[model samples]
Target chain A: MHIPFDQLKAEFKRVLLKLNFTHERADFCAQIFAENSRDGVYTHGLNRFPAFVQHIKNGLINIDAQPTLINNLGAIEQWDGNLAPGILNASFCMDRAITLAEQNGIGCVAIKNTNHWMHGGTYGWQAADAGFIGICITNSIANMVPWGGSTNALGNNPLIIALPRADGHVVLDMAISQYSKGKVLQYQSFEDELPFVGGYDGDGNLTKDPNAIIESKRLLPIGLWKGSALSMVLDMLVSALSLGKTVKQITDQGNESSASQVFIAIKPFNA
Target chain B: MHIPFDQLKAEFKRVLLKLNFTHERADFCAQIFAENSRDGVYTHGLNRFPAFVQHIKNGLINIDAQPTLINNLGAIEQWDGNLAPGILNASFCMDRAITLAEQNGIGCVAIKNTNHWMHGGTYGWQAADAGFIGICITNSIANMVPWGGSTNALGNNPLIIALPRADGHVVLDMAISQYSKGKVLQYQSFEDELPFVGGYDGDGNLTKDPNAIIESKRLLPIGLWKGSALSMVLDMLVSALSLGKTVKQITDQGNESSASQVFIAIKPFNA
Candidate 1:
């Protein structure tokens, strides 16, 4: 139950190698998964490992694919993720953003057709570790209802902001929704109510009942209308900037792949 | 109650000139105030004009002082607001940011010692109107309690994001708090409870009673811990980037006069 970090990472790498992953990619990804768990994000760490493997086996992830430059706009660059592993694509993009920032004081990179980055904060940490202010956002499948709407029309998009500090990096990574579907399902499994109103029920009343919300599939956006509007704008930002699929497009395809994402790095004045 | 836009602007300009504002500055400020009202943001429009005048009269705003460049980091620039009008300073910073973005594909400007820009959305619209993506944030005096803390420690900092669209520009302007103090005061004035939980009562229980929340001074941040963390990081960002006052410092100063703000503009690929 308390495996050592190195052992966990080695196990992940071994499994990836068995699946024909190159030595470098396997080790890099294994370290990320291990770090995610060590960092207490079990949901995206070992717990999600099996799903990730399954997706790869189903050809949803192209292990050998690499992100290719779409266009260069001075300090901003657009990339096509080529359906590659999200971790690698995101990391590569952030590195590019940082390089651009080093040249221009601010850099932005938008990537399209990317897979799910297991932990969005990883890129934020990457930039902060490099002594730059970092911001990133990603759009997902429509999983939330728009404000004043009865049907799902928005993604509970995640946003990340990181500021490097002398003591410790200050990072704020949040999803627009009050709670993720995984969280709701966890509460339901424990037969416990949410501590706060998580979503709307079938009758359209705000509720803490996980089952009701899960059944209705109407997760509440954080701050109600404020979060709804925020989610919509973020979705627009990512998709438009990347010129990629929108939430509706992703949902219509019956999968959550080909997501659009943006990464930005700003050289702090001190830097 | 139904004054024409021109009449309202003229009246504001006349009053501002009486307070010794130059004709150009007075006209610009009055136009912003009138546009806020015309755009249905009464809180920051005519309703706030008298307070703006009072601040000027009290020497809180320096009409003659202009923002001066502190340093230019290529695509990013830092400025000292010289305790000038927030609206003018913010507009000037955004314009500079836009110009930088035009040259480098992205740009950022940070200003310190600025007053409150009446409506934060005004800057967002300014960028969108120029066919660019805009993002801005500003710190305020401490007003909301941090997560897991009973005392006031965080500012209800506002964030604005805007994207240009053919039909209409999509803009999101939101404070970290679920309900702003102004909104709560409005509800209290009408003897009406908030439509949802706005803040904590004196006993530390979430409540919709505006009077109790006001008395307790425990406004709830959006998404509870999430928003609290966001506000803290935003405060850290603006202050760290500008080397200006934090929420604690602003609160200690007994007035929200020398606030720090950041404006960012990104050139869209199509642009």
Candidate 2:
């Protein structure tokens, strides 16, 4: 229950190596997973590790692939992630964005075919560490219903904004939904009601019962209609910029693989 | 109450001409003001026209001043607005940004010493009309409190995002506050409580009473803490990018003149 951070990372690395991950890939992915757990994001860390491994074994993620350049538009670049691990693809895209920003004051990089980049804040922190303003967004399998709709038709896409400061970086990571599916599951495990309405109940009314929301599979978006519109636009932005799969397309594929993402970096004026 | 659009534009043009505005300047400003009224944003259109005249009469607006180029860094440019009316300065900046974006795939223009641009969506629509993605933000006088702080130390900055579409452009214009001061005032005039809590009462408790919130002058931010952080960052972003005055400095000057703003435009991939 209280394994040391190093031990946890070692175990993860060992498992990935057995799954045919290269040494460098195993080490890098293991470090990220360890950091996620250390940062208290166990949902995307240890808890999701088994599912991640299963996905790889199920041929949903291609571990040996690398992102390939799709287009170069001066300060903006587009890439095909080639279904690589999300962490690696996101990290590489942010690095490229930072480099472009250094050259042009601002840079945008969009990638398609990436996996779920666990802990979206990681790349935001990466850019802040490099002394730049970072903004990123990613789509996922549809788990949220569009405003006024009864069925799931939208993803609870997350947006991240990070600003570098001399003392500490300010990073804001938020999902468009009021509460994520992981959070609902957490509350369900405790048999607790949400403090505020998180989604609709069976009768199509707003409710605080996590069980009702989970059963309905209709997580409420932040600010209701506002969040719905924002999510729709963000989905368009990422997909159009990357020339990649949209949420509808990803949902139809029956897996969360090959998601689209966008990363942007701006070199601060003072920097 | 039901004046024709052309009549309203003509009235505005006549008044602006009498206030020493050049024919071209008066015509441009009058058209935007008329469009604002036609688009149902009467608060910034006809309802605000008398205040605009008063500002001009008080010499708070420099009728003849034009924005001057400050610096250009390839895809990014900076300008000194010379305390010109915000509409002209914002329009000029967006035009420059669109031009840069067309040449380099993306462009950013930051300006200092501009006034209020009235409805911020004007610039967003401007870019969308040009078939590009537009993003714009502006800092204003402090009106909202920061999260965890009791005093008003942040501006309810407005952000605009516009995407060009074949059928119709999608545009979102939002202020960081849950309800703008104008909206609160309107509710007060109607003797109605806000549909949702807008801000705090004198005792620092959240309330839906428009009168109490107006008296307290403690406008609650959108999403509470989330919007506060966003407003702070946006203020920093506009001021830092323009190398201009922050909200604190602007408030200290005792008027909302000489504000800072930024406009960004990106060429859509297909474009």
Candidate 3:
């Protein structure tokens, strides 16, 4: 099932072109998808393409709309994503942050009304490749129970950090959940149990079985209480910084768009 | 056992006065230690006081040496701590970052030759109180086994992030280890097994027994491979940004002094 990276990218580009995407847009999106698979993130790669297309077709994603500046606060800028493609908006915001960093050594950009950006690592790598350290995080619809609670009331809230290095840039992309939804689905495909405790089963016992976890919908928070606190912190940060939708607001919307996100870029002097 | 918080603060002040510390200096240091415990971080509070004294007594800490500027790169400034008490140096650097953020909307300070910052939350609270978001991280001597390796070659680096809020400023203080050295000691003292799987025993099997983990010194990285990569990224960031000692260098020095640290402060616009 492993296809050559170039072939995978070409296939993606072919589909995008057939969907009437501009050639440049199709090429860029295809390359990113290929890079995700090449870098060993299969969940965000080919496996997720169908869901992405479905979202586009459902009017959940506004493929042609672009982000517009809503406000500017000195070194910080706020943007409305216009419900555009998440990947494009994220990349644009990070680009703005890098430009700000080049002028001021540090810059932060926050965006609202964006779709899922697929792998957060993509923007992290983009910043590092441009010779800057980067950090980004996004809130999602509630899929986790708050600490000391027994119901879903929190988001997995993925976080990404990358450091620029002469050698391979070090990047970390993590979720507050022990296993993300995509990861749990991947495990379910094999009917395999998680190697470590993942989530709760029926009747509230910790279980490694992906199906049981999905059935119960109580994903274990990473580091138990620590992850819950961290997720709250990130949620507060994105919401407060961007003045955008919080996890609860996103949940109320009934779909996963219009989430809050923050991107920060810092550059070395020599850069 | 669970003494009133004020009594603990007074006791810490008494001990510092007995060590010939000036009255004001003693009060500042004691208040920080007490606050750490008040915020439920007992490991860095009363329990760490004796070791702080030991460092002072051994002439390893320069009680009166102040941080001095090394370089300034626009929004970023570098300082040399002169081997001062870790808490004092950390507070001073955070104050500098706060000042910079107030003027520029963002500020980053990196310090070399600094001692441990005690509870990293102290600095986070400092920035949050100043109406700025705060982030601080410190590299330590290697105490973690890298991914896919049995030998310890990574620092259990601590990262702190805090945001100002109308209710309580949300703060997250985390070490990269699944169980920090302090928590392990706590478990050992309480004669209780870890509530969940923590580190690995000698045979690389995950175990909840504190004694087995401490004896093996093979503490699990938080989130296994995820934390290993995060640790490496943080180490590289602290070292590279400050041009100070890396975890490898700190370990080779045979002790955990003269570490590298970074503090960042960002001001937010009115929502």
Name the candidate that leads on lDDT.
1
Docking class of 1: medium
- Please write out the lDDT profile of model 1 over residues B1-271, one tens digit for every residue: 5999999999999998998889999999999999999988887898888889888988989998899999898999999999999999999999999999999988899999999997999999999999999999999989899989988899998999999888999888888999987678778879999999989998889999999998987789998888898899999999988888899999998887899999999988876
Ranking the candidates on TM-score from highest down gives 1, 2, 3
- Model 2 TM-score, 2 decimals: 0.94
Better of 1 and 3 by TM-score: 1
lDDT tens readout by residue for model 3, B213-232: 88887777776776788788
* DockQ-derived CAPRI band for the predicted complex in model 2: medium
DockQ scores for all the models shown? 0.77, 0.53, 0.54
| Best first by DockQ, ranked | 1, 3, 2
- Which tens-of-lDDT digit does each residue in A50-168 have in candidate 2? 98998899888899999999898899999999999999999999999999888888888999999999999999999999998898999988878888898888998898888888999
Candidate 3 residue B194 Cα shift, in angstroms, is 2.9
- Per-candidate iRMS values, in order, are 0.9, 1.8, 1.8
Q: What is the TM-score of chain A alone in each candidate?
A: 0.96, 0.97, 0.96
Provide the lowest-lDDT 10-residue window in model 3 chain B: B217-226
- Model 3 off-target regions past 4 Å? A1-7, A269-271, B1-11, B14-20, B201-205
B1-271: candidate 2 lDDT, tens digit per residue: 5999999999999999998899999999999999998998776898778888887888778988999997877788889999888899999999999999887888999999999999989999999999989989999988888878998889988888899998999988877787878778878989999988889899989899999988988888765666777788888878978989999999998888889999999888877
Full-model lDDT for every candidate: 0.91, 0.88, 0.86
lDDT score of residue B146 within candidate 1: 92
Best by TM-score: 1
